[model samples]
Target: MKLSRHSDYALRIMIQLATSGDALVSIRRIAETYGISHTHLMKIVQSLGRAGFIETVRGRHGGLRLARPAQDISLGALVRHTEGEDGLVDCAGCLIAPACGLPSILAEALEAFLKVLDSYRLSDIASRGRMLRALFDISVPTNP
Candidate 1:
């Protein structure tokens, strides 16, 4: 059950925002911090913004911040929004698929994986705010 890079970036973006609190963070800075391409991060940021997880501001002093509090942003929901609802594998037209339980097993495993993620919010993972801020070399907001 490998998550796509898109989903991975979405999670990273969420964590970055969570650690920053309400402070606006630039995509270019985040890309530089994570060593990802600005173009790729832009795509991910667009997706997240569309999904209402983050808000983007335009113009000279513009940047981005989480749309909602980190405590309200469920990891599972974010993954589902970014990763889509595609099944882990395609059993259609497979030999012996009717008799095979692999599909159900995989489905259950995926459910379990998501269940664990569902139990946490961005704040849960970003609770070590100071550490994360220092790691990213970003100043943590005093009021977060």
Candidate 2:
């Protein structure tokens, strides 16, 4: 399935924070690393904070960090929080809803996808590790 750019950004943000170790990272750094707009990244940060996935700190040292360990954060949770797709297609406005099995099939598939994601956490990603940080040279903040 094709994930939206927003979903990709959310995953990128999570992976970055997971790999950063102990330091808080800024949205600017994340946007730079992923080559995304700072303004868009800010919106993602706000959404994640509202969903309880990440915490925001204030002041000069203020930045972003995972609310919990990487392993504790599930990819499914992140996707749900970020993507929020209930089905493969937009069936709500579809003219035919009762006859089509598309909605049911899509629902099952989506559930299975989530079940697989639920198997892994941010910690798993961290443990296995990825080279996302090097891709953009994102430096973790020392102060926050």
Candidate 3:
């Protein structure tokens, strides 16, 4: 199953913040470090904020931070917050809802997928992110 770019970026932002270890990070730094649009990342941050994954601080010395410990945030929860309740297939309100097996198949797969994701926390991914980035020499933000 392929992931959306938005979800990918959100995970990056999470890891970046988690690795920074108490440093308040700004959108521009994240955007520049990841080579993504600050505009797009800002929207993702806003959604994550709304979902209670991350919190935003205002004013001159303000930025963003995780709302909870990295290990407490589940990937399934993050994706649900980012993508909403619609499963992989949209058969619930589809025209083929009368006869298609798409809904059930998607529901089953989605449940399994979420179960797997739920097994890993933000901390798990953050550690993995550091290793993978280091292996590939990817310039992930390691400090504020």
TM-score of model 2 relative to the true fold?
0.86
Q: Which stretches of model 2 miss by more than 4 angstroms?
A: 128-133, 136-144
Per-residue error at 19 for model 3, in Å?
0.7
Q: Output the worst ten-in-a-row residue range by lDDT, candidate 1.
A: 135-144
Question: lDDT of each structure?
Answer: 0.90, 0.81, 0.80
Q: Cα deviation in Å at residue 70, candidate 2?
A: 0.7
Tell me how many clashing residue pairs each candidate has.
0, 3, 0
Backbone clash pairs for candidate 3 read none
Instruction: State the lDDT of candidate 1 residue by residue for 1-144, as single tens digits.
Output: 789999988898889988887789999989998999999999989989988999999987789999999999999999999889877998889999989999999989999999998999999999999889989898756764
Q: TM-scores across all candidates?
A: 0.93, 0.86, 0.82
Tens-place lDDT per residue, model 2, 1-144, is 778888888888888888776678988778777689999999988999999888988889888899888878988888887778667788776778878888889889889988998898888776634355555465534542
True-structure RMSD for candidate 2: 3.6
Candidate 3 C-alpha lDDT tens digits along 1-144: 677888899888888777655668888878888889989998999988988888889989998888899989998888777666777865547777898887788789988988899898888867765665564344667551
Query: Considering lDDT, which of the candidate structures 1 and 2 is the better prediction for this target?
Result: 1
TM for candidate 1 is 0.93
